[model samples]
Target chain A: GIQVEQSPPDLILQEGANSTLRCNFSDSVNNLQWFHQNPWGQLINLFYIPSGTKQNGRLSATTVATERYSLLYISSSQTTDSGVYFCAVAVYYGQNFVFGPGTRLSVLP
Target chain B: IAGITQAPTSQILAAGRRMTLRCTQDMRHNAMYWYRQDLGLGLRLIHYSNTAGTTGKGEVPDGYSVSRANTDDFPLTLASAVPSQTSVYFCASSGTASSGYTFGSGTRLTVV
Candidate 1:
């Protein structure tokens, strides 16, 4: 079984500030996704980066498969961004999708 | 209306009772999965199906069962609900094992 760990278990940022969240996995992954669970508990897909970098507006993610870690960047954060961000991964040809504990971000206005 | 749908947005059940959680996806994905999230913990896989007629256990499959009789629906059943089973359950699907995923809003279940 592969293990997943996320850093900065909790974070508090002022609106308009920038922050970075990191996720590290125990093994190589064939699938990886960044998800945001809003305060209302709706899961939103942020990105599906297996081995490269992707940007979605003010949010972006970079995954170094070789290093077995991924980084998510949130720039100009807003109050709406106050929620938990999760990183999920499926190791090489495995059907199991393991999720990290998540980075709880609170963007204060 | 086009993505995954989970029924009974939330439910409260008595211990030892049997209950089924419904999940349906219209994306025609080849793979579906069930995961449970506890308070302050990340989601843990309970079961998964690669395609229709095939299913496999996940990291936390004990006491939980899943069946994929067709392509659109994957229902999870609990033989006897327990207090520890009270958690948020999420249903997700992907075109394939290596493809992108879509998750349901989640079913918040509580056992008494």
Candidate 2:
């Protein structure tokens, strides 16, 4: 079983501010993903990065598989971004995906 | 296009009652999964099916059961619900295990 830990369990940011959320896993993973659980509880996929960097709109994510950690960057945050961001990982030999506690972000206007 | 749809957005059931959570996907994905999310706790996998007719237990499958009789539907059953089973259940599907999963809106189940 792999342990996934997310940093800054809770975050409050002013609209237009930038923030970085981190996820560290106990072991190497074959799959890593960042998801946003919206106010309606819909899990939307943000990024699927096992390694390397990717960007979509104001969001970007970087994963260092060697270091066993990943980072998600949200720039110019908006009020609609107020929700929980989760990181999930699937280890090499594991059939189940494990998720981090999540980073609860509250973007205040 | 209904990527994935879960039946009964919310449910209230008495303890010891049997309930089934239905999930269906129109994408024709080969894999489907069931997970439970608790407050402050991350989603925990309950069961998954690689394809039709093949199912496997996940992290928390003791109190739950699932069947995948066909590619489009995967249903989870709680034989005897308990208070501890109160949580939000999410159903997801993927083309492959390494790909990103498409999740449903989720079903909020409460056992009293």
Candidate 3:
């Protein structure tokens, strides 16, 4: 089983501030995804980056597969962004998708 | 278009009762997975099906069972529910492992 660890277990940011969340895995992964679990508990897909960098709106993610870690950047954060961000990875031909604990972000208005 | 539909948005069941959570996807993906989410613990996989007719256990599969009779439907069953089984269950599907997953709204289950 691959071990996944997410840094900055909890974060509090003022609206309009920028923050970076990190995820590190123990082994090579075939898939890496960033998800936002809103206050209502819906898992919203953010980015699917196996490797390389991708940007969606004010949010972007970069995964360095060789280093076995991924970074998620949130710029100009808003109150709506207050939620838990999770990083999940699928290793070994996607046999299983393991999830990290999560980075709980609270964007204060 | 409903990407994924989960029945009974929320449920409350007596301990030891049997319940089945229904999940249906219209995208016709080859892989389907069932996961349960708890406070502070994040999401934990319960079971997964690579394709129709094939099922495998996940991190927490005890007391939980899943069946994929076809590509569109994957139902999770609990033989005997317990208080600890109370959590929000999500169903997801993906065309391929690298393509990421589309998740259902989720079913919030409470066992008393």
Highest DockQ scorer: 3
Q: Which tens-of-lDDT digit does each residue in A70-93 have in candidate 3?
A: 999999999999999999998866
Chain B TM (all candidates): 0.97, 0.97, 0.98
Residue-wise lDDT of candidate 1 within A1-109, one digit each (tens)?
Answer: 8889999999999999999999999998988999999998888889989989999999999999999999999999999999999998888664567789999999999
- Give the TM-score of each candidate: 0.96, 0.97, 0.97
Q: Report per-candidate TM-score of chain A alone.
A: 0.97, 0.96, 0.97
Give the backbone clash total of model 2: 0
**Candidate 1 Cα misplacement greater than 4 A, ranges:** none
Task: Write the residue-wise lDDT of candidate 2 on A1-109 in tens digits.
Answer: 8999999999999999999999999999989999999888999999989999999999999999999999999999999999999999988633567899999999999
For model 2, residues B53-104, the per-residue Cα lDDT tens digits are 9999888899999999999999999999999999999999988777778899
Give all candidates' CA lDDT scores.
0.92, 0.93, 0.94
Cα-based RMSD of the predictions, in order?
Answer: 1.1, 1.2, 1.0
Q: How do the candidates rank by DockQ, highest first?
A: 3, 1, 2
DockQ of 1: 0.73
Candidate 1 docking band: medium
Better of 1 and 2 by TM-score: 2
